[model samples]
Target: MSDKLGITPACFTKLVQDLRIHTTLTDSRFIQLEQKVGFLLQALRHSDGVRKVGHRFQHSTSTIAMYIHEVVEAIMTSKLYGIYVHQPTPDEPTSGIITRNPKLQPYFGHCIGALDGTHNVFAVCSFDLLFLHLHAGSEGSAHDQKVLAWAIEKGFQIPGPVKYYLGDAGYTMSENIMVPYRGVRYHLREWIAGARSSSRETLPSTKQELFNLRHAQLRNVVERIFGVVQRKFSILTGSAPEYNYKMQAMIPLLCAFLHNHVHINDPFNRSTGKARAARMTMEAKRARLEIIYKRTEEALQNPAVAVDEEVDDPPEDQPEGLSMEATRNEISDRMWIDYLKYKDGPRRRQQVPDHLDELLLAFDHEGLLLR
Candidate 1:
């Protein structure tokens, strides 16, 4: 096959070999991956708006899609994001593991990337592969839990103990990933509310209030990552067709890889980080949270457990980004929290209200709304 207009044949072959990916190509199928990757990333950043050179190069849709897939696969396999899991070693610092060279981290340990799933909408594909397991429709937002599971199983699985993912209630707690703040009825919005209330100086704590503030900070990171993706790639800004799940799945991963690439090579990306960080700073973030509370704060009788007035509340340190397991899964086959809450095996028939009290308190807009 002829090479892409700008790339030499040798470089083309090397790029394909380096990617170790197979896909259908256009008449000029064997184009260098550098050229192909360049075009695909360009699409991710939407540099050309709705169309790019590939659109001008006259490649068939199939060929363009193939190149895009190959590039995505390569990025998924790459460890450029510095996301990895590391185990606590005998010589390791006990508190707050230093985020450093990912290469040295132990396989499957503590420094795991905190991943959460958000839906990515996309245009429909011409021929949907009915048998393909990946495309089951429903846009990507079926649930954050499923997204984390799929992500872990994909090119990257969550690393173990040393690295656990920090996600929200949307994700079910897993070994390598932790969903802190037990299915808080309120999440990003709650954090925003807490921040706003606290801005005026929230009363320190009854274990619940303190713990709530602590987890709020930790969970914000995952949300920030999602915001970055949507902000950078507007293609993900729309709702995807329910029929094409392949494109749906591709959007998030593609955007993620694009963000990482831009971070590495784009000069503009340098300021992007600094600017976003500044925007994400606590004060700014609370101001940006656009949540409309759902539950009304009608207080039911408090639990028999008294709020120990003199217990000396724990320090308001950032809550560790770990789902506090009621007990290890080994001790209980059910969702570990069910075990922690009750030793008896789970009965799905017995439904528990998700963060009921919390939801009511957080989302509910009775007297709490600011004038």
Candidate 2:
């Protein structure tokens, strides 16, 4: 069931029930809501043309097209959209990643989430992988900063004056936008490989390096979320279909809504559970791991993947009222001071590389977003 729809039967059943209550979907004399949803999912899952999809479903292409659009409208206009793509409230507490991770809490307590642009989608996600905000339909070649500016003009709230989102070097740092130290060792693989080396040459030695390392780790959640959605929906992985540009633009948002639904319901296990994993041969597993790693590396390097790819740092000077640069310097200084005290203490351990590798491996597996 999940193979065809990318959603488990149990969750699908629940979703159908919700659609009945929250959406305007109703059973027709010929086709029912379940079948309508099936058409939508199948179309999204396989990326088949309307004619091919109609042939497979034994319906005319016109009927399939109408039903798919109906389903899209039902879901998009439904209350479920708000629930799945919810924004954080102003009074929302610190993200779990910050409050729970001792290394991050002190420095990033003011952070509301991470922001990045992936392909044609611009999004802000909390550290725990929840989609806090999303804007789709931007041109593929649009710069991250430009997309962000457009979103803000469209009334995308920054939540508060001090609260900000972590971005990569490509974005202009401001009071509400915190970016990593440019030209520093920021990618996880660099730090992980350094951890395995005896010389430890890649390990962070300065406050900026350490800050970038931590920034990369926390900011990685946005990248992983983008990867998860693109992997789950086949239509998103390829070129745009023949649909009109407006419908094409809505596809990413539709997938994001469903992705959030799956994440909330299936929290730990993937849509395809242990049975699928068990059927895989060891060689296939290794092949999949390599592919996952390759994709991760490509995502890190691609400017459109997470709005993150290394670039020369932006100028230090900011117009009045924009001072995230100064804020970052203060945080780095405090972090360095804490690190010195910790290193002098008896409990210091150099196991961060192993921990980093474990995180990388976890994402390589089938269920990368495990809690």
Candidate 2's residue-wise lDDT over 147-179, tens digit each? 888878866788777788888777877778888
The lDDT of model 2 is: 0.74
- Pairing residues by index, what is the TM-score of model 1? 0.46
Instruction: Write down the RMSD of all candidates, one decimal each.
Output: 15.6, 5.2
Runs in model 2 lying further than 4 Å from the true structure? 188-196, 270-308, 312-317, 320-322, 347-371
**Predicted structure 1: lDDT:** 0.37
Which candidate number maximizes lDDT? 2
TM-score of each: 0.46, 0.83
lDDT of 1 by residue, 159-205 (tens): 43443444444455554444444423233344434433532233222
Candidate 1 positional error at 195, Å:
4.1
Name the top TM-score candidate. Answer: 2
Cα-based lDDT at residue 219, candidate 2:
81
lDDT of each: 0.37, 0.74
